[model samples]
Target: MTFEMLFVFGLLAVTIALFISDRLRMDLVALMVVAVLAVSGIISPTQAVSGFGDPVIIMIAALFVVGEALFRTGVAATAGNWLLRVGDGSETRLLLFLLPVVALLSAFMSSTGAVALLIPVVLSMARKSGLQASRLLMPLAFAALIGGMLTLIGTPPNIIVSGQLRAAGFEAFGFFDFTAIGAVILFLGVLYLVFIARFLLPQSAIRETGNPHPTLSVFTERYPTAKQLHKLIIQPGSPLNGQTLSEAAVRSQYELTVFAVQRQGQFLSTLQPVLSQTRMQALDTLILYGRDEDVHNFCQALQLRRLGFPETEMMKLQQRFGLAEILLPPDSPLTNHTLKEGRFRENYNLSVIGVRRQGLALDTRFIDTRLAAGDTLLLAGAWEYIRALESKRELVVLETPAELQEIPVHAGKAHMALSIMLAMLMSMTLGWLPNLSAILLAALAMILTGCVTLSEAYRSLNATSLVLIAGMLPLALAMESSGALSFVVDYLIREYGNLSPILLCAGLFLMTSVLSQFISNTATTVLVAPVALMTAQTLGLNPEPFMMSVAIAASTAFATPIASPVNTLVLAPGNYRFADFAKVGIPLQILALAVTLALVPWLFPF
Candidate 1:
């Protein structure tokens, strides 16, 4: 290899390392790669930023806006409610309903968007039904992935490959061109998950599915010391503001123990004397602990009737558990403190249900893992105890039905967003419009119709993905430009040139599949698409089959969370070990490869 080749190769390796390390945002990594290429003279400055103007990049950005509109309007959430109602509390019923629900949603919506909308509902149902969360979450994630494969706009990789194919002078894929093969794979994939994988799937995967409605009577019977009580949030300017527990004379006057105080979003543990130094503030939430008689007395004394306590009518004996969310702050004392060290249960008297960090839900083992800033913890305990902890600064409560209901939704905007997306897909598939123009128009429509505000739309775009696609596009171009792709193609053909096209396609498929498991699928596709094109050129065969194989292989990330965002989203929620993917995914990967190899040639006819 020439020195230039080695330098280019080294730069590519470093860029990939940084991307996977996630020490920097992906967009930054992409820009850095472009900078390195320019600085090293491998590509020009103009070329470095050229991908920003690429049509594929533009389309992705627009689609992001469209997706945000769906989310903003709660259409996705509304659709998910159906599945939530069906799953209610049965694991078997949930799996049966969720698989198809997620699949249908993913076929049109973004996988990440679809999964995000469903996760909360799934958790809620799991709690109600007393089912394991692990059993349902993986299926939810897998279904999204499988569904994405069925349509042109299902996932980014499919669109990227289609653009690359068009750029290489072949026809772009229609909205449903790959549906036949993708549908079969989707069916088989869902079946494998429902029947076989569930058995092999780990029990820990379902750890967060706690019973939402635990019978307090049963709990009192078992642990008679456990008291049932109401926790009150003292809104700012409330009657209780600016009063100390001692000065307020809660115990003497109201006959209630001031178990905890949440003032200014910080929880003060009355168990420690130092806590007495802190004064009450506006918006302080008080966790008053006492027997049922004292709770009534405390409420009467404070003139605070209607504490919104879960009553017998609202509380199913099976469905009366409390839910609280806590976020680990950067300077929290709990940071780096394990559950054992933090005396979590002893200190708070709550069971940690789940954790969310950086938009991913974490497993129960997270208690053993050191808490970090930005980590959100979902905990289950008595209503009083949870309210007390909610006052602490270390944890942020994410679920407040009133707050959720307050989020703005533009119902009409959802229809416009949906229309724009359809138009883009139709224009691109029918050859009447360039993919770039169609996408750009769609993005404009979203903004114009107020489906997504301009600022929100811009914020939703995955800048890293765009940068990565743009930055890598040149390097991929350079390989073809420099005859490097042909060199690789020459080497492969010489070694396996005499092999049947089917075997050659199989080899290419396997290579792309393995590469995707380690690197970004877009990166894998950009790097391999050129070689597939060159290999087909060298073999004097149609390139369509080769390209189709690469597209399928790149998107089928079955083995690792790091392999795809969808996988990462489920990591904490499902409590999946890295090996979990291998167990379920390895077989799926084989099945996908088998299906792709069998169908691609027959459909595209290389």
Candidate 2:
């Protein structure tokens, strides 16, 4: 090999090592690769950063926003809930329902985005169905991978292979050419997972699911507001100002219970619980729980100055505002940051009234407490502001109280989101618009029509996926530029030319599948598809079967979590180990190989 080719191979080796080590974020590793490639003078600076503006990268980013819109607008969850209902709380039943539905959705969008949308859904389903999360999460991810095989836009590898064919003067793949084989694999794959492979997965320690009556209900029960709660500020001149709770005897004298107390301050210590011996200082705001008449009677008895409005006015805020419950999903950006740090109120105009964690209410320090996935928040805000959160992929609004549903911020909006998604899909399938144009328009529509916000559209993207794609792209360029790709392809053809056409195809499938298990399927396809086509031409055989073999092999990225973004998304939520993926995924990879080998020759004769 030439010096440039050797240098490219050495760089590829180190990059894969870093990816496998998991010591750094994939995006950072990718940036390091880009920096090295640039400094080496292997490619122009423009080419080094060009993956940022690549049409495929843009398409992937737009697809994430579209998926988030579907999720926030409740379109995807509606489908997920339907599948859960159909599963009827049985593991076998849920698997049967979940895999096909996940696959079907993946067929239309990015498989990684599909997995992200369903991570919460599957967790919720596991809770409702009483199945182990580990049992369901792997199936969800694998099904999304299978879904990628069902359509042109399902995964990057499919698109790359089709582009290779078109670039070589052949027609690109049809939208449905992959469906027949994919459908079979999906059907059989679900059965394999539920019946055979589940034994290989270990049950993790996470509280995957439980009763829906969260910690807020406990607070509502203890405080027992008699249809009235007032934000009352104690005045300095009042009779109640200098008295402790025991001495004041507010409950005995005025029939009021102070459930919480807050004083204006600069730190997290200001908000605290009501202790009987604690004396109230001037301007201390107490949330009093009592009957409407009792509250009025107490106000008349004591010199408590009412701050903004009475309880009745609080009800009026409900006409414009509402209260709802939400749970943080895994991978929430809101986690690790307190509401103050997140600018929770300023961004959304919502107020967090209380938070629930593990069946305990946290009224005090609600804003200062850092959040975590699966923690619940009881929030109040204007209906529009609350509805706006519906598009935030990080938070899953569990239920909107029927009382809040009186105002109609949600009216006809779900249908609009669905219609927009359908239009985008039809445009791509029918070749009415370029995939990039259709996706960009769909993302703008999501923003213009209020499905998601401009800020959220930016948030929906995974920087790791984008940067990884951008960084790895140069490797492909380097290989091609240095004549390394041709060298490898020629070497393979020379060594294997004596073998029969079918054996050569199988060898291509094996090489591609093994590489994909370690690297990106899209990158693997980019490198392998050209070689497969060239080998077919040299053998005087039809290129379709060989090219199809390459495509199929590239997607058999099941044997490792690092193989696909879809797989990595489930890593923490499922509490899976490295061996967990290999134990189950390796068998599926072999099965896929057998299926591809048995099916490709018959489907398109050589």
Candidate 3:
């Protein structure tokens, strides 16, 4: 190796040392590597910074938005819930369903996206099932890696290897060509993780899923609204059926607040907001909050039938409406006036459900009780209206229920989000659009269609992962440009060429897998694929087995968290140490190698 090559190798050594030490952040180390290469004249500044704009970085970032949309729209939660029901509290059963499903999804989409979408899901599942996150997360990352081996578009390395074959005047790999070995690997991988790996994983302190903020039950108990809130169905010929909420003025007539209306349709029912011009129809169920006597009097006078407002129905209503604790400022104009006297519902469109004075919840009628400057009011309204209260200078939003975060803003638009995601998936699978283009369109569609808001999309990105991936890409470029990669590959093949072809394949697999642990697997494949092809040709053997081995080995990036983005994504959530991966991953790596060695030659014999 020349001086520059030696220098590049030294820089790489330091970088790896930093990564393994965990003393500095991974992204910072990657940035330092880029800066060193540029300062050392190893690479031009333009090339050094090009990684930030690489298609890989852009694609991963876009995938974050799509994953976030899936999350915010409840798609991931829906899948997680289904898996939970199928698993039925069995860890092995959960793994049986989880591993293959994630792998299959990874086969069709970006592995990073698949992992990102499911990390939260898996965490939620683990929390619910009483399993260690570490036990389940590493397997998730590994299965996603295996998933890339399932389809041509599953990962970049697969596509690169196929293109390499096509360029060599051989038929390109069919879409499902990788699926044969991949399915076997997935099956064996599931068995390994379920039986062996679980014993090896750390029993980390579980991240609590329970929110600290007060729940709906807490609000209901404090306000004593369970017995007070009632649902009334408007009967035929009721005078209130054809009148709008503004015209009916139930609050004015009976002192009961019409919080919302549940309208039943032929196929489905909808929760309608009680707006000024919202006209009630016959058979409409009205969600009301007031004293029992007042509610009974209103129902009796209006010829309405009272229905039991069960806790489950209240929870469902909580999704459409929000509950918040508001404190009246001392200088507030409405501080001395009662809720009804202040026209609270008409002026603010929020009904005061309960009042707490000096830390004591009032047991008496709060609507007619004069409000105090320091009194706390429990308000209920649509989420939008509840959110609007935050801007008022006269009142302080002391607390909002934690359930609001769990509620999807686009819950009603779940089907639309699902359709968009399916369309994106189909476009990618059928090659109707390029992967990056399809991802961008899908992310944009999510925002445009309000499946996820712009702020939510922005919050979805993992800055560390994006920076880490972008930063390391340049190091790969430097390795390829500086001849370090070729120098090592050449030396290895030159020394080992006279050996048996099987041994040669083994060596190639080992080299590719080790290199993939530190650099981009796509770069690893680009460099080693040619060597594999040339070695087979030199030995007068068919190149298919060697080429296939190289591709398979490139995906065995399980030995390090930095080996693949999938691995990196799970590093923190799994609370894994460097040795944790080596302990479990090294064995899995060896297993994959054994499987590839035993199968590739048999499947594509010379």
lDDT, candidates in the order shown = 0.64, 0.72, 0.82
lDDT of 1 by residue, 58-157 (tens): 6556666766666565454444445556655556666877887787767775675566546655654554355677777777887888887888877777
lDDT of 3 by residue, 130-165 (tens): 677888899999999999999888888888878988
TM-score for all predictions? 0.53, 0.63, 0.82
| Clashes per candidate, residues 3 or more apart or on different chains | 20, 0, 0
RMSD of 3: 4.6
Top model by lDDT, which number?
A: 3
Pairs of colliding residues, candidate 2: none
Q: Name the better of 1 and 2 by TM-score.
A: 2
TM-score of 1: 0.53
Query: By lDDT, highest first, what's the ranking?
Result: 3, 2, 1
Stretches of candidate 3 off by over 4 Å are 68-98, 116-140, 169-172, 191-258, 266-269, 275-281, 287-319, 334-337, 357-360, 364-369, 406-420, 444-460, 494-504, 569-584
